[model samples]
Every structure is written in structure tokens, then in C-alpha cells.
Target chain A: MKKISILALACMLAACAHYSLAPEGAHTVQGMSFVSTTDWNKSSLRSGAKSEVWTKDGERLNQLTFIGGIKDGQTIFTSRSKELPMPEFRANMLPNELMELVVTSLKNSSGGELVIDATNLRPQRLQGSIGFRFDMSYYDSNGLARRADCIMVKKDDRLNLIIFSAAGMHYYPKEAAEVDSIFSSLQL
Target chain B: MRLLLSLLLLFASLASVAEGAQRFEPTLPPGYAPDKSTDEGGLWYQVERFEEQLQTSPHIIRNTALTEYLEELVCQLAGDYCGSIRVYLVKNPHFNASMYPNGMMHVHTGLLLRVANADELGAVLGHELAHYLRSHSIDQWRNAKKSLGIAAFIDIGLAALHEDLHGLARDVATVGLMRYNREQESEADAYGVQIIATHGYDPAASVSLWKYIEAERGADKSKDTSSIFFATHPKVENRIARLKQHIKRYGKNPKTDETDLDEFQNLVVAEYEGLMDEQIALQEYEQTAEMIDRHAAIGYPDSLIKFYRAELHRQRKKFGDERAAIDLYRKAATFERTAARSHRELGYLYIKHGLNDAAKDAFESYLEITPNADDREMINFYLETLR
Candidate 1:
């Protein structure tokens, strides 16, 4: 009976640590609504409004992130106890500046752990609002090349962003279509 | 007041040295290696593991010219012992250099950026080499092991077994790995000047270098100059006087010693820009401004420097900053190799001040210059709004 109770507590703790996001229906995330066409495991994020992870081969090799309703003067990265101050996210920041913010955040938080390269930006329409989309190629700490597709939009004095990323090899190619479908299903 | 205090401390250090301390001799001769069965060999093996890991670290700078220059400078200071020591340049933005037990020295880019010329670089390298020659890490490790053994024994006896205590153990080990006493630091400082004198580099540059560090610390009290070595050493104020004493003892005529300013700038300026970008990203505007002021006064003008200057003003947005940014951006754009985003930033500033015609021109120029920029759609949107 004691062993059973311990097992149940461990299961509960695991569930609390890794939450699942419903994939078959629309979800409102921090005032931004979107529909996920594929199952993704929601997890606590250090930054951004909401975060989810997708694993392959028993490892968390892919991630889907949503940053919604970021207010003016707020930063896109989390504050650390003894870390240097971070740059704030201004509502009027240009797309290039926004890109720099993401790159800088990755570099600063990683302590030069990650190297990122973003390619040309394309026009994207999110819930009928004008937005910009870009693709990035980066190397993680272990020198694993990863690819990501991101969209950024400023709406009603708030910034909403979404990024879907996976390992640059087989995993990214396998999930690329599903990621595009998920982005296509975004709604206001 | 600080200068006076430093002088008094210098006198104190010289007076103390008159206690007739034995001069240190290098224990490890040229091409020395420990036997595999000994404890020193065990330490070397562990350090080899760390060196392997460091080789794969993303922060390791891999520029061939830069690495070669650093190794050459280190070798110049080390002389006969040069063959056994390996130098690794790291990309951390703090002013520090460290030597491991296995003759591996890691020099941070921050230290590289802070030094004005080759002699200053030699001073820092010579100090680190002094630590290596003396094998201070072995002493630190032995002392740490003794304390850790006692702590572990007590903890085990008390049956205070908890998962949290594992982290405590790691913290204790890390702290023990460093924390050399004041005696080791003074020895290293004194011997470091001897190495500089032997190499025909300016020994007084050590004093000047510490003063530069002192001035930087005074400018921004928040900046951490502490490294593995500085964390436990006596205050910089005391060290400055000791370094001055050594300079008086061993310094060559300034005209006879080599600064190698031209070669240092050539090898370091390109990397300096990248390091400065890292600083700008840190949002420590005051530190970056001080760097800009120092470099600009030295006449180190380049497109990247101008762009960052404009970026500094633009980010602050104080009174007249917008106008200053505009002018600085224009100057930066005049350089044929300026960053493409400078025009885009110019467009934003022009639009904010209701200069639609100028905004359009700037946006067009930005698009033309960076036809494949990642933010084309947004720039186009701005262009449409301006039209």
C-alpha cells in the first residue's frame, strides 16, 4: 500500500511538470487564440506567454513556442538572479530590431552557447493582420544544427510571436508540413 | 586620494618584501612531464579532460591569426617553458586570464579587448605563466581536498543525507578549486615583472594596465573584474603598489621595450568589434559608452564603431539623441562597407520625426543595399506608409 501511494505521487508530479495542450480544438493562449493541428506537450517556459515541446526518439528535439500579448517596455527573455539587465521589447521596434532582440536573447541567455543565423523575411498574414515571417538556422550547445520558422506581428499595442523549430536533419523535415498547417490554423 | 593610498600601499609592499623572501625557481624544466603513476599525473589527466571539453566549447575563439598571435605572445614571455604550455582563448566578456594545473592557460577576449598594446598583454600573460610555473593549483587543490574530506566525514556521520546536499558539495568543490591566498598573488605579480623584463617588454605596462582596470572599475562599480584568481586576492589598490615596486626593480627604458601597438590592433580590432557587439547586447550602456570613448580617442574609427555609436544614442533616446543618431547614422553610411541595417534605422528615425520624403529615400536605400534582408516585408510596409 505504501509503494502504491508513492507511485501515485510520482505520477502526479510528472503530470504537473509536463502538461499537454489539446490539439483538436481552438485554444486561447494569453489573449491570443490558435488551433494546433498536432499534439504538443505544453511545458513551463522561462520566457514567452506559453511554450510546448515535441519529442522524437525519446528526446525533446523539437519545440513550438508562442509569445502573446507582450506589453510595451517588457522584455522577451526571463530575468536571472545575478544576470546583467536585458533589453526591453518596445512596441514600435522595427522588424530588424525585433530580430536582433531574439538573437541577442539567445546569445545572452546561452552565454554564447548558441549560434543563430536567420535568412530572408517573407510577408505573413496572421488572423488577417500584417506580419513578417523568417526562417532561421542555428547550432545548439552540442553542435546540433536546428531550423526554425517564426512569425512576428504587432497588434493593438501588443506583440504576438510564434516559433516552431526542430533538429535540422530528419526531425525538422518530418515535422515541417505539420508546423505550416498549425500556423495556417491560427485565429484571432 | 586613491593615488595616495596606492603609493602608501606600494611602500608597504616593498617594505614587506625586505623580509628576505626566497626567490622562486621553476620546478618544471623545459619539456617536463610527470610520471603517470604519481598524483601530479592524476591531476594532469583530469586537467586534460577539462581541456578536451574546453576545445569543444562554443565560446572558444578559433581565429587562426588571433590564436597564433596569443600563443606567440605567451611563448615570448615563457621562453624555455613555452613548449609545455598551451593557450586557449575564450569569448567571455570579463577581464580575466587563468592557468590550469596541466599548463593550460585560458585567456578571455575581455582581457584581450581591455589591453591597449602588446606590453600590457605580455604583462597579463606573464602573470598567468607565473602561476603555472609555481603550480599554485596543486596547493589550492590539496588544501581543498583536506577541508572537503573533513566536511564529508562529518556529514556522513550525522546521517544528514539529502539530495540538496549534493549541490552543496559541488559548490564547496568549486570554491576550493580557486581561492589562492595573498602570498601566491604577490609572488606571481613579482615574478611576472621579472618575466616581462626578461622578454624585453615594458614591465611598467603592468602598472599602467592595473590603473586602466582601476579607472574602469571606478567608472562602473557594477562591473565584475573578479575571476578565479581575483576573487580571493588582495584588493587591486594593494596590487597596484606592488606592481609599481616590481616595475622600479626590473623595468627597461620605455623606448627600448616593444609595445607592438600596430600588430596588436591588426590582430585584435576585428575581434574587438564582435566583443563590443556582445557588450551592446548586454544592455550595459555605460560600459559600452566608455569603451567607445576610449577607442574613439585612440582614433579607431570604423563603420562598425560608428554604427554602434549611433545605436547607443538611438537606444537611449534622450534629448537631442534622435538628431545625434541621425547624424551619426549618416556618417556611418558614408563608409562603403557599413551595415545594411543602418539605412533601415535611418528610415525609422526619419518617419518618427515626420520626414516622409527622407524616410522613403532611406527605406529605398536600405532595400537596395540589402536586397535579401530578412525584414523586407516590414521595410516595405514602412515604405508604403511613408508613400
Candidate 2:
């Protein structure tokens, strides 16, 4: 647990809406830009409505979509040592679906009650891909349940995101819809 | 008027308890309290605060109908068998069961959701009861008085149970109540065996019960099993080994009908699949590691390993890993079709990757499926953003 000064907390909140142009800075990937809503994919798969997906080179490769995102400097990211090291397993797969499958399975598996309140979404970042967030229900049966709210940035056609799934009973209270608003409306 | 005013004042004081030296806070908002008012832990003021908070929630354990069934089993067993005692169903999923100084026992929902059978469940309940007869929570509190373990009792995690006490460093409360002391646990297990036998519940079920827990531990890759069980108890292998060796003492025990246990089964059946998967979602690296180890050790179903692998991918922040987790979540959701949360995560995945329409649809889909969701504000917020 790191000591977050009031200043640091303020910085994070302030940065929530602030996005730099492509090639942002050190913590950001090079040549990254926010995809326009027009290039996004509108899928009817989402509860009979369209979902927008922004991807690299105008393709679904490493796309950034939303519900909401969950963010935490310390907790969201898992150990990547194994994933990077296990290149042999990923040898034949396309990089995009490969990553999407991993994140998707991670969120989908934890079991809990499927709750979709109009406001149950949470936002989180995808990994080193770029800057993206993901959403899922709090702990559901694979766990309790958290609604998913995810965000990400597309850079060099890659995706980076912060993801969250908490015991809806415990985790959701700390960050949920507030995070969703922070994510979807984020200009960066 | 005099008595009424006094009561009103007392209620007001209890309701407004601040974080205190005596009062313990369960992580998150909701908390719990033991039925017996008198706590042997020398922290009666904390207990007083706990009593105050317990008023609103009453008992935090869910699936009330099932909990009542479990309580009845314990009470009935307590009446007939020598060591059977009262059980308080708890809502938490952390693996713990306790016996207070008084005869009352508090069992976390984690135990209820995990235990396989009524007999095994009885075994855990019986073990806690043994602590009451043995009087463990008080004795340990007295022995370690003024220790940092007690001092670090900040309100975090579970409101009733301190998550701080969960780590090896925080051995504040001895493994819930009975599971705390080895000698006590052993004594309880032995007595529980005898009690189960008398009640016509298979005594062998006790050994198998713990084996299931250990097996679950083995299957989890991220958990540090040593701390979950070993760190708290010194001679870890021996304790489990002893239970194995001791249960055999009553040779060739006849099996009890699991049929009569159906109502009991029906009671907890709802939470079983949900609990297992729910815990999967609460997957801490240590917890996953621990579950993997326990399951492998006891030879239970190794299916959870796939989840561990998926979680491993989740922890890794690369696009590849996130994609992998999403797919696994999909499979898990499919296998667990009723899992609205799983579907919601899919919805969330769509949202995070610049897929607003997808996010909206996923969120909307999620609401349609779940009976109740606490994230109404969050879901609504997303909907508004999309609009």
C-alpha cells in the first residue's frame, strides 16, 4: 500500500478528463490518439443497442470499448511475467483476439448474480497495451458481482487498459459509476 | 419517561460510535456482532460499538432461509450430542468459523458456501462449539493481551471480522474460534467425530470436510496457503494429519443417508455454485494460489485451475491478457448461464475499449438478468454517458 498524498489524489482526479495528443509522455505509448466515434463499432450484441469500438488502423485489432472502468494504481494489474514469458502458447494466434480473449475470460468467469442497473457500471484500465479501461460486475458467482465499465487508448494500434472486479458488496462502493463517467467522457 | 429517555440516550450513543479502541470494523460498510453481549477479549467497549452497529443489519449472512436450517441443525445436534452448540450464520466468504467465550458460535458464509455436505458442515459447526466448551477466544485474548496483533485491530475489510487479523502477522483472533488453536481444534475434531457419530451423521465426513477445504486451497495458484492456515497454526501438516489419523479411530463407520440432508442441501444449494464462483471473482493472487494447493492436496475437482490461469491473464495488463480474461469469463459465464455478473463483465469489456454502444448493451443486458444489483448508480451513470 502506497501513501497517496492529497496532492496525488487530486492529480489523478484532475487527469481524469485531461488527455494529451498522440505521443503523450513517458507513461503513455507513442503515436496514440483517441478514435473518433464514427470509426467505432456499434454492436447490437449489447442488450439490443449499439456499442462503439475504437481500434487500430480502423480495424477491431486491439479495440477500446466501454461500459465503465475500474482503476487502482496498486491492485488492478496482475503479474505479467508469466504472460510475456509464455510466447509459445500464443505463437499461432493474432495478437488482438489473443488479448481480448484473455481479458474477456478473466471478467466473465467469476460467478455471481448478473445485475444490470442502469448505473451498475465500473471503469478500469487495460494493461500496457495503451490506455483502456474495462467493466465487469462486482463479485458474481465465479465472485460476488460488479458491473463492468472499461476505458482504453489506441496507440500504434495497441490497447492499454485498467480493469476492475470487486466484491460488489465491498469493491463497488469505492469506485463504480463515478469511474464510468470519468472513463466514457474522458478526452484523453 | 425516565427509563425511556435513558434507553434513547443509550441508543444514540451506540449508533454514533466512531472508530474506537474496542470496536472492530468489518471491511466495506456492512458489519456483524456476536449474540452474547459479554466479550472475554477485554475489549468490551469495542464489543459495545459492535452491538450498536449490529442493530441495522441484524445478521449480515444472506440466504436467510438456509442459515436458519443450519442453525436448527446445530441446535438439534447440540441438544442430542454432547458437543453440539449454537450456530450464527455469517455473510462473509473468508474461510473462518469461531466460538466466543460464551457458547454462541459465528460461522462465516464462506464456510457455508464451501462446505459440501450437511455432515461436513456439522463438523465445522461442531469444531467451533468445542471452542466454547474449551473457551478459546477469551484464553487467547488474555495470553496475547497488549500485543501488536490486538493493537493493529484497525477497522478494515469485513466490519465484524478484521481482515488485518487474516494475515499471519495479525493472529489476533485464533482462526475464527475453533480453527484457531491446534489443541483446541484437535480436541474439537475428535469430539465432533463422536458427536457426528451419535447424531447418525458419518464421522468420517469430518476428515473429508477439511480435505475439501485443503483441496480447494491446492487448486488456487495465487494464494499463500502457509499464511491462510499454516501461519496461524504452528504445526500445520500435523493438525490436518492428526485429523486424518484420528478420524480412522472409529473404524468402518456406517454411512448416513444424504437424502434426509436434502432439505439442508436445498437450503444451501443456491449459494453453493454461486459461492464457489463468487470466491473465484474475489481471486487474490494468494487466494488463487492457496485454493490450487488445497484442491491438489486433497484431490478435489481441479476445475478451478482454469480460473486461476484466466486470473493470471487478468493480472497481466497487456492487451493479450485482457483479451484472454474476457474469453475465459465468457466460457465461465456460459457454463454458469445464470451468472449475470459474467455477462455484465462482457458488457464492461465492450465499454472499456471505446465501445459505448457495446457498453450500454452489456450494462442493459446485465440489468435484465440479475435479481438484484447494488451498482444502480454506476449502471445509470454509464447509460447517461452513452446518451
Candidate 3:
């Protein structure tokens, strides 16, 4: 799978990715921007310009996905992979329904059944806008436990989402402070 | 020595019973416990651990009355082995009912929702019980080990060597053995029909049960069966054919008297809305609509069924769905036994179509019913807009 990550990097680069390099500084991605506490690798992996990935050790252990400016009828998962059906994200979807879409995406992308551990839904401020926040723990199909923190809001019939997910054993707690800081620095 | 002799005799007796024949009494002889020193015993111990986890798992449905109802049904079907069997109702939306070596069965809510009547459910319960009666799990474990052509103890010793690795290996094995072979499944089917028939349930219901599954699978195009190793799967087509043959051959007029629709509804109607919610979460709109219609046709609460029908229309949002959704939501909201969310949703649909007076009344009713709803602010905003 690590070999797949290397191949993925080459694939993204050859696919006309928009790359931003910074030594632990602020970054503007699509219509949303955030400051990173650590030097992060940002690339258009799924959808060019509309979606981006930031990771420390690639997506194997820890990663942050930025799914921004998705139109009213667009789906959150932009994977062109035809392996599994994609879950859609509609503008009129309730907060809980949108979260269900996220979990469905996680399961479909991973190609495995998932067991949710905890779900904490709270009203949180996102890019100076009132959005919903979700802190969740779940086990992936590979029996790898993970934690995800996400904030999502809909504006002008478009979805702006930022998700931070990492291995629950050590990586999640280790990088939690940085993720929190980055979330705080978000602007739309 | 006595236990071994008894096991041998029991297996020989079970093997002697022919398919589509009556008078096959399923009796569990004394001394069925495996020695802890054996590899099969190790499997049993692992299964016990799984049972323990299942007992406290959040996915377990703990509704006491429902649990008691299922227990009684299993007891009726199990007969001699009734005391040995245990059933767990899980909240999963897949059509499955699994039995472990330790006589622990996990029946999914999907199975309940799919089965049209008690007799259909009885057929499933009886099939799972038959697996336990015939000791298929132990046989499967032995077969798997043989198929791998590895010494069972070598893997057992490795499992004993590392506790964590053993846990992981157990999980993998559990997933691998989720389904039984075609022969075993066929035998279980035959045995289940006989058992339910003996217990006064219509044996013909088994045919209808598989028909439902076949129809559901036929409608689902996304499920890729190309790579599936269904070598031993009684392939739904063959099973339906064999089941019909068995029903004819058994020839005892396979009692068709009791449908038990009322009892089935009384036990399951309260759970339809919640199970439908799980189905909708997967965003399979067509499948969800089919399920709602099936239940509604068979007389589930009109209020809940209409609400879900409205939700199906609203979420799918086809050209005419929004208008249809408004009508259904309004119908659901007017029902006496409605879900509180129905009125709230009706209010939103009303506001969407710029019907302020109707929207205001719906919002007020929703707030009156659910004062502490989480989306209170959003509902209030709609109400203010309507004002």
C-alpha cells in the first residue's frame, strides 16, 4: 500500500495537480484557507482545485481532506474509481444526513465495513460562520481504529468541508493540537 | 470415550436422514462439550468471547418485549435444543441470520423487515437452528483447516503464542466463515422446512422468503457477484427450485393455516421507522422505497410509512417528487400516531413552496410536539419567515 502511495503521488503530479509548498505556514486552497502548524503536503488528489489532501505520512495513517465549494447537487466523493457507488451531498441535507454521507464515503473508499465508536455533534464556528462539528471514532475495514474531526457548512448552495482523520492509537492525539490550530485558522 | 462414541452415533444418525423426508427427529445426545485442549475447543472459546461482546454491543437491540418474542419463536423452533440456543437481534440492515458453534445466533433487523410473515421468519430461525443441531461450525472449521492443508495445532499454537495476533486471526476467520457451503445450506433448508412444518407453520413460506431475497438481489445492480465464490451457495435459483420440490415431496400438506401477520406486526411495526432510517442513511432510495411499500402494503403504521414515503420523495427529488412529498408529508402530519419530525418536515416543504399560512401552522404543531428539538433554531427561523 505504501508503494501505491508513491504511485499515487506520481499519478497526481501527472494529472495536473495544483501544488502549494510552505514550511509550516498559511495556505489558501480553492475558496477556503487555513494556516498549518506543521509543514504539510497539499495536492489535488480527487478533484483538481476543488478537493485537496494534506498529510504527514501520506494518507496511510493521518490526513486532512479539504472538500470545498461543492455545488448543490454535487457529491462529496469525487473519486473516478468505479469500484463502489458514491454518496451524494445535497445542499438541503440536514447536518446529520451530511455526516452520514461522510461515513458512507469513508466506507466505500476503504472498501470495507466500518463500526462507529462515538459521534459528538456540536455547533461550532467555521470560517466565521456557524457550522456543525463532528468528532467521531470508528474502525475501518482493516480493523484500524481511527478518529476524525470535521466541520462543515453550506453557503450559497455549496458545501465547504474540512476533515482531519488519523490513526486512533497514537497519531490522532499526537497531531490533534495542530489540527485544532489549523481549524481555528480557517477562513472562507 | 463415551462422549466420542455418542458423537459418532449422533453424526451417523443425522447422516441417515434423507432430504424431503419426514420423521427425522433432531435430538442432541448428552456430552456435546469439546475438550479445551483440542483446536475445535479453541474455536468454541473464541466464539464464546464473541458472544460476550455481542451481548453488550451497542448494535444489539435491547427491546425486552421484542427480545422475548424472538426467544419464544426460537424456542418453539429449536424443540430439544431449545435450552442450548441463544438468539441476539442485531440492528444491521442486511438480510442475514448467523449461528455460531456455541449455539449463539445473531439475526439482523434486515431479515425481520424482509420476511413478510412469521412463517417466513420461522423458516430462517429454523434454518439457523438446524446448523447448530448438525454441528456445521465445527465441521466447517475442520474443513477449512483441511482445505488449507495445514496442521490445525500449528495455527492454534501461533494463536496461543501472541494474544493480539490471535485476536486478529480470529476476526479474519470469523469473516471468512460467514456463510456455509451449498450442501450444508441445502440440508439446513430441508431441516428448517420440516421443523417449521412440525411446529404448525406453513412450509410454503420458505419459498416466499427466498423469493423476497431473490427479488431484492435482482433489483440491486451495484452488488458485484462476479468475483464472489458462491461455489457452495445453494444459488438462490437452485434453492428455490429444490425448496419447491421438497415442499411437494414431503407431502404432509405442509400446513398453510397460520400466517401470523398480526403477531408479526405487533412485534415489528414499532421498529420499522428506525430500520428504515438506517436504510435511508445508505442513500439507496429505490431499495428504501421498495421496503416502505412492502411494509405499507402489509399494514405497518400508516403514519410512519407515509412519513418515510414523503422522505423518499423529498430526498430523491425527481421532477414530480417534491410536490408528491408535500402531499404525503401533509398526510403523515395529520395522522394521530405520527412521528414529531413529520410536522417539522412538512413545515419545511410548505415554506419551500411559499405556503406561509400552512407552514406557520405546521411549524407551531411541530414545536408544540417537540419543544426540545435540536433544530429548534432552524424551525423557528422558518416560522419567522412565514410570519
Candidate 4:
């Protein structure tokens, strides 16, 4: 049961368009540019026009997601069905509301199995715009405990965000410093 | 002789009509084990592996006392089949209790939060047990296999069995494969009522549970029916009417029947706040508001209800909501149990409104109440900034 059939794996692969190598140093993706101190593999399965994801080992191990220039009424994640109640971004949202939006969006995206605990909300600057930062800890689908650091800013009535998540037991502590450095180098 | 045999068959058919169809009996024997060569056995193998994963899942509430309570309650309802069942109380904020063919049962926290009494909880659990006893999931699986061929069936099974797959994929596969037919649902509903009434629980509790759910569903502006339980089950109004009919047939003795509200509340109080937090996180304001009010009507502490009400207001942040939240939080802070969290929220609101002195006071009160709070450093930073 642990091993998914090759056909099922192929079906999953078909859903993804492709992957590209995100080499070390400065790179522009979507609407923002950032400098990566290390090489990473980027998924071509963008959720929207302004969102992209990069991974070091695999998506389950560690992932860095960039969502940029999401307009008001646009959801943080792309939902397939109109019935799904994905939270929309609003320009007038307060700092705490933004955190809630992310939490709700993630919960909905995961189909409510994930138990997320978000804490340590504080203000930070992201590419010269005042933004908020928070930490979240939750278990993934495979019951692996994971942690994420998220930073979001509102610029020109649109939302910009970066989230780096990794397994709490090992990968998070191993890659946290590099992730922080990369986040620091983000320019919008 | 042939004429006599035909008359006897006709009489049997007439008797069945008089009884309004034969009642569904449990097909599963106690401690039943299917042979490995059979398709049912293959399904069991898949489920047993999923159970292994579930055992390690973070979502499983590990509270020994709560788990024991639920197990005992299920044992009471299950009777001879008790030994075959294993109950898992999952920390999910959705109203659901699901039963697997292999006798693994999951009771979600949201259901616990919503149920008014142990009898209501028993009603829901009994319904799930009825499904298990009737082997509804297996029947549905076999039906799907007959219609779709073996290859497609295995694909559906593997999609549900794969741990690496996203929840949406798994849910779609599971819902499509395990959805019981209308007749099976009615059978289970009838059995659920019969079992609870036999156990001396108020059969009307089943009707009450459905009515509450129907109202809660109506309260939601978005009418989001994404919950697996809501999606896979029959319509709530229909369920309510049918349950009422069953209750009427089963009869009720109000003075003698047990609700066990006190015991249910006592056992679940420890997990209440966390459960409410998860519910609030769904961001379904009107529905959550209705739930909070219903919980209040059940006699949960006013302070706790007020705090959650304030939290809903704070999170929703509609026009003039912050003021309403401030008022509620201020009221809640008068109670010792909720004082610390209320102060913390008040601090955040005060800071947001640029009332620096009030923010400092509220934060200090929060720190004093919860000296070792996890966010102490962050609170201290805010205090320094205010100075």
C-alpha cells in the first residue's frame, strides 16, 4: 500500500507541466526578483500568474513559494472549483487579517486535515514595504511535522508573499539560515 | 402440490409487504476475517494499511481519557461487535464520524463540539456502526468495480490508498468509491435509531442532531457543502424527516432516557478551546456564529462563549466589528479563565488603534496572567516600542 502504482504516479506527473533548475545567485520570477544563495529546483505548476514554487529536495521536504502582485478579490491559492471558499485578498486588510487569510487558505487547500498553529506575528519590512511575518507549525499528509515562515506585504493594492516550509525535525533547522538570507534579498 | 407452493410464496410476499420490507440484518459476523484471495480481503488489506498511517497521524487526538470514553460509548452501542471496533477521535473541525469496513471508526472534534449530549453523540456513532455492520462500503466498492471494470477500480482504490497524494485527490477517490446508495443510507438511519432506543438513549436526539445541522447549514451564507460527510450523505432535511419517523416508531420515555450532558461536557471541556479555534479558523462567520450560540444554549460558560464571539468579530473585521470585539473581550476579561487571552487580544486591538498606554496596560496584564506565555518575547518587544 505504501508504494503507489506506476500508473498513478504517472497520472500525478501529468498534472505537473514541468520543472526547471533555479541556479544560485540572482533570478527574476513572476513579478519579483530574489537572489538564491544555493541551487533549487522550481516547479512549473504555478498556482496563478504571480505565484511560483521552488524546492530543494522535494516539495514534501522543503519548499519556498513566492506569490506576488495578487490583486484584491484574487485568492492566494488557485482553486479549481467555484464551490471551494478560498479566502480573497483585500487591500484594506489589517496585519492580523492577512495572517488569518493565509491560515484559512492553507487549511482549505489541504482539505482540513492539517492542524496549523500560527504564532509570533510581528511587523517586518519586505522590499521597502511594511509587511507582517509569522511562523506556522503543522503536520503534512504523511504525518511528518513541518514548520513554515511567511512574510507578506501589500504594495499598490496587491499582495506579495514568500513562504518557506521544511520538515521540523531536520530540514527546517538545516535550511532556515539560507532561507532567511534568500528572503532578505527579495526585491519587488 | 404446485398450487399449494405458489400460495405459500404469495403469503410470504404479502407478509414482507405488511412489514414494509425486510429489515437489513448485519451481514458481518463478530471478529469476521475475509480470505486473502477475495476482493473484500484486498479492500481490507488496503484499509488496514491506511489504519497504520492513521495510527501515526498527528490529527489523532491522543487524550487517553477521551479515547477511553469514546471507546466505552461505542462498545455500549455495538454490543456483540464491540471487540471488532477501534475508535479514533480525530482533531478535525468538521461534523463527521466515519466507519471503515474493517471496523475503524473516526469521530471528529467538530461533532463532539456540536453534540448537545452523549445521546446525540451515540446517535451519530450508531449510524456509522450501522454502516459498518451492513458492510456498505464494501457493497459500494463492489458496485463500482462491476460498473467501471477492475483496472479503473484499482486506480480509484490506489488513489485513495496513496499517502503521497494530496487530500483532494484522496477525498475525490474515496467519496466516489464509498458513497452508499439511497437504500443503504435509509437502512443505516433506521438501524441507528433502533440501536440507540434499545440502549435507552432518547431516539428524538437523532432528529434533534439533524435539525441542528440543517439549521447550521442554512446559517452559512456561502452554503459551502465541501465537507466529506455533508457531500457523501443524503440531504439534511430528508435525513431529519426520516429520523423523526424512525423516532416515532421507536417511541420515547423522556424521564427514563439518558442524555448524559454533564458527563459529555466534562470529558470534552479540556479540548474545547482548541476545537473552537479550529472552527473559527474556517472563516465561515455566520455558521460559526450560529454554532457559538448553539453551544451557549447548551450552557457552556458565558466567558468562553464571549471570548470566541469576540474572536470571530476580530477575525471577520467587518465595519465596526473591532468595536464590538473590544466590548466582548472586555466583558470576557472579567472572568479568570479567559482573562489572559482576552487581554492579549485587547492589547493587539489597542495597538492597532494607536492607544499606546491602553495597549501597554493590556499587554502587561496578559504577561502577568501568563508569565511563561510562548509569545512573551514578542509582547516585550511591543512594550518596548510603546515606551
Per-model TM-score on C-alpha atoms: 0.84, 0.50, 0.75, 0.87
What would the per-residue lDDT of candidate 1 be over residues B282-351, giving only the tens digit for each residue? 5656666777776676556577679889988887656897899999899888776664667888988888
Candidate 3 structure quality by residue, lDDT tens digits, B301-387: 888888888988876767999899888888888786674767877776776777889878888998898788766765665566566
The most accurate candidate by TM-score is 4
Question: DockQ scores for all the models shown?
Answer: 0.32, 0.09, 0.13, 0.40
Clashing residue pairs for model 4: none
Docking class for model 2 is incorrect
Candidate numbers, best lDDT first, in rank order? 4, 3, 1, 2
Off by over 4 Å in 3: A1-31, A34-65, A71-74, A78-84, A91-100, A103-150, A155-157, A163-185, B1-18, B22-31, B151-178, B222-232, B249-261, B351-361, B384-387
Ranking by TM-score: 4, 1, 3, 2
lDDT of 4 by residue, B1-387 (tens): 999999998995575344333455789899988898999999899888878877777878875776888899899999999999999887777777777889988788889878888888989999989999989888988888888888987876677677542352346346466677776777788888888888888889888888888888889757657655676677888778767767777688464533455777767676678888888877778888888888898888888899999999988878998999999999999999899999999998998788999999999999999988866766777898799
* Model 2 per-residue lDDT tens digits across residues B171-283: 33443422355545556666666556666776677767666656655555554444444555535455566656555655644555656566665665445454554444453
Model 1 chain B lDDT-worst window of ten: B160-169
lDDT of 2 by residue, A63-114 (tens): 3333222222221223333311211112222223333433433433221112
With a 3 Å backbone cut-off (N, CA, C), the pairs that clash in candidate 1 are: A121-B374
Q: Which ten-residue region of model 3 chain B has the weakest summed lDDT?
A: B161-170
Q: Model 1 residue A21 lDDT?
A: 54
**Cα lDDT for residue A92, candidate 4:** 71
CA lDDT, candidate 3, residue A148: 92
Span of ten consecutive residues with least summed lDDT in model 2 chain B: B19-28
